[model samples]
Target chain A: MGDRERRVVFVTVGTTCFDALVKAVDSEEVKQALLRKGYTDLLIQMGRGTYVPSKDSGKLNLQVDHFTFSPSIADYIREASLVISHAGSGSIFETLRLGKPLIVVVNEDLMDNHQSELAEELAERNHLFCSRPQTLQETVEAMDLDALQPYMPGEAKPVVALINKFLGFPV
Target chain B: MGLDAFAAACCAIPVLASLLAVRFAYVLCRSGLPPTRPRAAGLRCLIVLGSGGHTAEMMNIITELQKDRFTPRYYVAALTDSMSLQKAQVYEKSLIQGEGEKIIKNAQFMQIYRSREVGQSYITSIATTLLAVLHALWLIIRIRPQVIFCNGPGTCIPLCASAFLLKVLGLGWSSIFYIESIARVKKLSLSGLLLYKLRISDQFFVQWTQLQQKYPRAQYAGRLM
Candidate 1:
């Protein structure tokens, strides 16, 4: 726990990018609160998002590192103490796999409100917090890492079992 | 071997091997073997990856399955998907360092053109698919994975299809395990539907109960988030 105090707040919006999520993270209130909590660093993986903040997003006295798409986010996920991301399945599942405190920002503008379903489902399970661009500040302030549910392995057991059985292979 | 088995092997293996070298007929005559059974443990696996979520979900699978049991893993994805390649490389490295397991470094990046390309003619799409078929056949032949795992993605189709063909012919024994993406709640993706309808996938798993109930064939794995 002592070593974790220096970890970064990872904000990611997946491969295609969602400016909405990036904008939500670039708020004065969220930055001030995070600074007060002794978190001094922010890492954002913005993907192909078009909106770039002013020349510097480090105005709030927080060290910020931002990039467009990382080859592998595993290292970032591992280093993060808190993760704020778009409700892309890849980001959500990867964050959950590591049992990080995650705030999923659903891109509601998608064709079917598709991302909302997973975000809402995880929220309902108390696995992670779901936030919207409108509520980002408050949600960031209210996050409780220990309160989030830890992920369990084998959500694919029945399927894996059946595949092995059908193939007459053992697990 | 039984008389039928011997006769089929004699006629199938060499002919199919030779046909795979032919320009276009290779695509049409690829499936020339029977379904090879896998034992309880100690099997090589080829995990088909799509970019983004497909790769993420598969990496989770690699972390879950006992490493020693599923040895010499091979991950395949589209040639252009550097994200998938990078993630696979990281996962493979982590597995080796963390678990003290050795992984094969040569990954298979096949040229699987998307089935639904916007504004592209059907003929062009078919040509690309035929190309993908040969590439996948070469992969399946080389890796000869006892089981192939995939989450529903268009890129996964060609490899899974080629594996299905191997089962149809009598020369291969790779089992196709298709797991629907966690995002699918009500229905299967195009790849899932195709694999299910063709009855090629040995086991189909769905994350949501609603999806399982809708597709009687799909087994539910308690919500993989």
Candidate 2:
């Protein structure tokens, strides 16, 4: 237990995926699985309860936290080992720009399946890993930062120059 | 057939023939012209006249054109005075800053005369059309452009009418009307119907293949953007 390293998962669920994540965290099967895997903490957000420590366990080693709105989300992304988030375009773009591994959960019922479409497109382009509820864990585990490095659009120079030239500016 | 019916049919023949003649002339003129040469020398200007989502798309095209040889000018008219005008200005400045040449050198926010009730829509449209016609006439007189291009909805009606009047009055410039994407999606609007009545424009650029089959006067420019 002392040798186990600490890792944080940053999650931002706008509206639709909030309930699903809560359900996943509340399930006994998921909690037991995490416990078995030596995971020390669970950050449950959007008014969900914390992971209760066992009677004989030392200091309730696993802790779950919640956040309504925190300005420190950007700082969290810099510090976190992995990011699990909704498939919003802004979030996806920012995460990719920062060179971080992302596990995007698509909200099916919103905006004519735009999130799903965007996620699938990014996946096809090998930019990021995407999943629905059933395969979220697998998708998260499958996210290889090294493989994603090749796909990330490195610098903003090319796109910026293209836009500028289109606007009738000298390249 | 009765005498009145015979007389009516006689009147229809010339109308149909004249329509056919216009169609033939358009086809012949378009076919004879060469492909749009990228490096063709002249200050080629594309004037876009709409202020909405369509205008945003047009801005994208203008941006693309700025990268190329054509110089683009945007003339925006809309029912509301919201963020679209600001967006256009931003795009204009950004393009100028980046290119060191003004792609959208001239942009005007034309006023839209609004109507509250359904009945007033017609009156509103007529007044707006007349105002636009006068404005376009002045612009043509001042600028004396080589070609006037129109992407339709509200702005096309008056601009096309002004262009036709200029042509009829013996002005040497040519005009091209670009039918909007919505016309391809569904039936023509009231403005489109009115544009059909003009009858003297140099060319009609339509997206649909069926438009060419129905009205042979329309040149199939594929998609302008």
Candidate 3:
């Protein structure tokens, strides 16, 4: 019960196979950055990605764990000190809502380039760090945890009120 | 004399059809105004759930609403989408857990046929879409919801269209609200575009400011993720 705090960095690729992200997060460069940042543990939700972390990753002064998928990643996000995730809105918003520091890595190979649009907009607002697989290590190195502003949860109240008012329902 | 009357009948039919089309267009395109009759105490809300991201966003939106006021909620998803209905079930269970005191009740889940399968030919898709439309109409009439809520989902097209048809026919009506997906930063999804272009959605919402600027009809709702 009196254990020391375990600062964990969670990397999630969501439901898609983002092997590049899995490989990048498993690399020595990113691990070193995470270790230097005082993160004591590294966890990866590899999804359908083919890349697997080497068994010796735990010898690098960080406890490493990897899994293919979970029913829900909410608990993991809550446990994370920092989340490195894919740029999918589901993962991004979940982390933001949980008020965790996040780095969204965009998959450049995907035909739909619009995912980057949301990441860029959010990054511009200092909500999260945005990166590609190639630059993930650099993003991890340059991340400023304190610089990220806590995302104010989006409200549906106004919209609901408008709909009710339009329908002559009491708002 | 018979020949002359036959020709006159053809002209009259065309004229009547054109007039009906114009009137329908006017009804759809008119500015938003409150209904003359006040809505009933409790609203039967029909929520359309799409694929993964859309369903997640919808669940978030549903969480924000006052569950008591929106009684007898109906959730509709595509037949092929197995994950979405399961998610809905999980969400409803959580609602029961979250609010022990109120214990909001009466939520139903329904699945409709997909208009087109992946890699389906366009020629055959028309027939399936028509079937879907008929199925949607039946569902809408049976549910008779007062409000229909959907984000960017293709399945919503048939449902919203059915609701709008009811409105046009003056039989029964459900106000349609379309929220553009948050992922759509600069553009609307195909469903959003159709609803916007046809003036089918009574309230259209977009999350991004850039999208709102490009599509002025869409009100910027400030990122409802």
Candidate 4:
């Protein structure tokens, strides 16, 4: 199959239920855009959420695959061409490690706003794109996977060095 | 020099004088040489794992260690965190397979109550932390671990504190080492703040050079994972 034919978008809010993100993705506007872009497949992993797409939102009700939670989201992420995720550090890092086109959406309701801080820094470095619920649709359409900055994994595991230093050896 | 001159000179070099005074009084001392590791007998290492992200980061650190030197491991996971426990076990299994030798022989797993549960209030958190500390003291007594290790996690506060208290009481020989998470580019987490503020860890490590520059005492060992 052609790349476009197999393209899927994976949307996950990490291990917590996020109704806002799920709602935004389930809207008629997003479905129309995805249909126009030849994204025939979309998967949503909504943890502990109350909302479901139901019979509204056009074709999304017929084709979208969603679940309350999954043991591993990595498999789904690996299979997808694009990842839309909550701005959790772990999720962002995993996406970067896999070198996928990423759009980070922040849940502002979080206590620390730590996600906003992280997403802003990452966006500043051209590592990924950050969007809020209001702008997610436009951000998704504007993303160019080839133009995004690729993440380089770090070497020189500090844990071993730390352990060595404590053990009285020069790290 | 005269007594007045000597006093003035000592005050000028207060740091050096303090070190000398402490040595003279034998009031403060560094731990003796750590036990040789990776021998056929091996050293007992207790590695604490936090939930999710903390667990993932800690795994990278563990696998990076020379697996042959440490064996008969112990893992501390939060009471409800099967995720961390499973990850630890999976890493060990993969390590053993890679080496074609037993990297971890019957690694022990223990669970401790989390200091802060989901939706818990500040008051409840304080009570939980105190309870975890008590549990940690008992674990230290029973395990008598030679090396205790953790990165940044709220659950680590009680465990590391207990290890420090045990060493100070002359009741244990465990050396505690804390590594600030790589995600912590500028500031330390709550656990990092507690350990850094008190200087409890024998050697605290930061992944980024920027953090090392900010906290001169923290060793910049280069990035990991």
Question: Among these predicted structures, which one has the highest lDDT?
Answer: 3
When sorted by lDDT, best at the front, the candidate numbers are: 3, 4, 1, 2
Q: DockQ-based ranking, best first?
A: 3, 4, 1, 2
Which tens-of-lDDT digit does each residue in A36-90 have in candidate 3?
8899889999999888887477568888899999987999999999999998899
Cα error of candidate 4 at position A18, Å: 1.5
Evaluate all candidate structures by whole-model CA lDDT and list the values in order: 0.73, 0.52, 0.85, 0.75
Worst ten in a row by lDDT for model 2 chain A: A47-56
Q: Which 10 consecutive residues of model 2 chain B have the lowest summed lDDT?
A: B180-189
Q: Tell me the tens digit of each residue's lDDT in model 2 across B1-225.
A: 699999998999999888767755654354323234433434334354454334544554455443444443534444454445666677777866766654445544444432222235676767755665676666556555544445554655555555555554446344343444322422333554455544433444444455557666554544322
| Candidate 2 clashing pairs, residues 3+ apart or interchain | A168-B99, A169-B98, A169-B99, A170-B99
Q: Clashing pairs in model 4? A: B38-B69
Residue B205 in candidate 1, Cα distance off native in Å: 1.1
lDDT of 4 at B203: 70
Arrange candidates by TM-score, descending. 3, 4, 1, 2
Model 1: lDDT of residue B55: 70
Q: Chain A of model 2, TM-score against the native?
A: 0.68
Please, what are the lDDT tens digits per residue for candidate 1 over residues B49-136? 8877777667766666766567667877777666687777776776556545345443343444455454579878888778767877
CA lDDT for candidate 3: 0.85
* Regions of model 4 farther than 4 Å from truth: A1-4, A33-38, A55-62, A156-158, A169-171, B1-41, B96-106, B122-126
Chain A TM-score relative to the true structure, per candidate:
0.86, 0.68, 0.92, 0.86
Q: Model 3 Cα displacement at A113 (Å)?
A: 3.0
Residue B33 miss distance in model 1 (angstroms): 17
Residues B81-183, model 3: lDDT tens digits: 9899888888887887777734446688889998998679999999999999899999999998777889987889989888887776666766788989888
